[model samples]
Target: MKKFVSLACVFTMAVSVLAGCGSAKTETKAETTGETVAESTAAAGGKLIMATEAGFAPYEYTEDGQTVIGVDVDIANEIAKAMGKELEIQNMTFDGALLAVQEGAVDFAAAGISVIPERQENMDFSIEYATSKQVIVVKKGADVITSPEDIKEGTAVGVQMGTTADFYCGDLGCDVKQYNKYAEAALELMNGKIACIVMDSLPAEQLVAANEELEILDAELFTDKYAIAVKKGNTELLDQINEVLQTLVDEGKVDEYTINHTTK
Candidate 1:
């Protein structure tokens, strides 16, 4: 009877020990998970995913095959380097880029985004990296339509959708045809589907210089300051980007980049 009791006691102690070991294992797992999470958050500091419409030239565009390049990409890479972070570029449309940043799907956007009062409601903009004058592009030797008002009624003015030029077309009450890409808008103008295209001065000039079929109108339409954008209330990220941009400007890095990339 005493042996039976001793054996029962041993069994009970063994079960107790097993339970304690199980509890210890569970706690260790929880602690490990917590540590992993903390480490991940810390490592993610300043790491940015940037979105851009890869179709806008002199800003962001594809060069060879899948290689995206432009002023915005260069600036973004520089900012990331300054912040000790990695920059991941997501190629998207202009509207998609804005929506991604607003939705927190991206850390920021640098698709030659213009700093406009209307956009300020949804996103924070960094300091202006570049300024571009707006110009009208028409066929070479065509009737000189200097201003928006000079465009005859029913004349189709092509513009990239969701761009400053698109808004300008609406504001000017022109017969506007919006395209997804600036190249497409320029092509439509060349094909006579649209009478002309309204675009930033540099891009318009580049296109006109490349295509003998196009020319810039003598009149200036407007000017816009291009900025990188982040979600509204993302002041932390904005300040970091702005700080890096100011440093670059002070060091003349921006001027060097422009000189190297700008069409001569």
Candidate 2:
């Protein structure tokens, strides 16, 4: 299951963004060998595929249009290396990445995924390796949603589908527009299509810096811990990942990766 077959499933199901962006990659081990990615001549062991959406900055985002890179990539790569396997990344929509891991179409997902009770039912998660808060991004001086208390029934808001932001706004009775990419949602906000965007604080910072007209509203929405998602019942791989994550935390490499990817 962890052989060459792993690549075929992803290219067919969740690679719509590859023509312009990229994808994370993996394989699953059978009873004895426990191989979840294909063996490559390039690696003495094999490959571990990771699924991610390259739209969230500092956590996961592509600097060059062709290759995806960020804190998640760095952490996933280190996890792969520690297990003696090479890492391959696939970039797709956030929702697609979530489904891919649950389906075991890829080995795991490392897209700054939040560990929540709702998602825990479908997939297993590694230890919490990162943290982020939800924030509102609105046009500067637009008093539309200055505080979470300001959100009203049917207030138009934007969020990436299947993210915590989506859940937050929906629960609060916001009329939500769910986009596959935060960039898409941001465009709508600029065009006055949506009142604001609900996104992670790190990515909101990146978005605000890139667009002077947008500012993250002054209010705390939600704080979420980020973790890697593995196929449910895949304890072998989950155990391997948790070990690496613990080491990264002990060495402060997680923070180092975040700083390196974050724009000054």
The candidate scoring highest on TM-score is 2
- The estimated TM-scores of all candidates read 0.80, 0.83
The local distance difference test score of each candidate is 0.80, 0.85
Name the best candidate (by lDDT): 2
Question: How would you encode candidate 1's per-residue C-alpha lDDT over 97-208 as one tens digit per residue?
Answer: 9999999999899987898878888999999878888888998766746566776455678988889888877776779898877778877777778778988887776677
Model 2 score (lDDT): 0.85
Candidate 2 lDDT score at position 1: 69
Give per-residue CA lDDT, model 2, range 1-264, as digits (tens): 675688887776666656334322222222224443323312433778999999989888876786988999999888787777778899999999999999999999988799989999999999998888888899877777788877767999999999988888898898989999888888899889999998899899998888888998878787988999999999978988998899999999999888888844
TM-score of decoy 1: 0.80
- Candidate 2, superposed: residue stretches over 4 Å from native: 1-45
Candidate 1, which ten residues in sequence have the lowest lDDT sum?
34-43
Judged by whole-model lDDT over C-alpha atoms, candidate 1 comes out at: 0.80
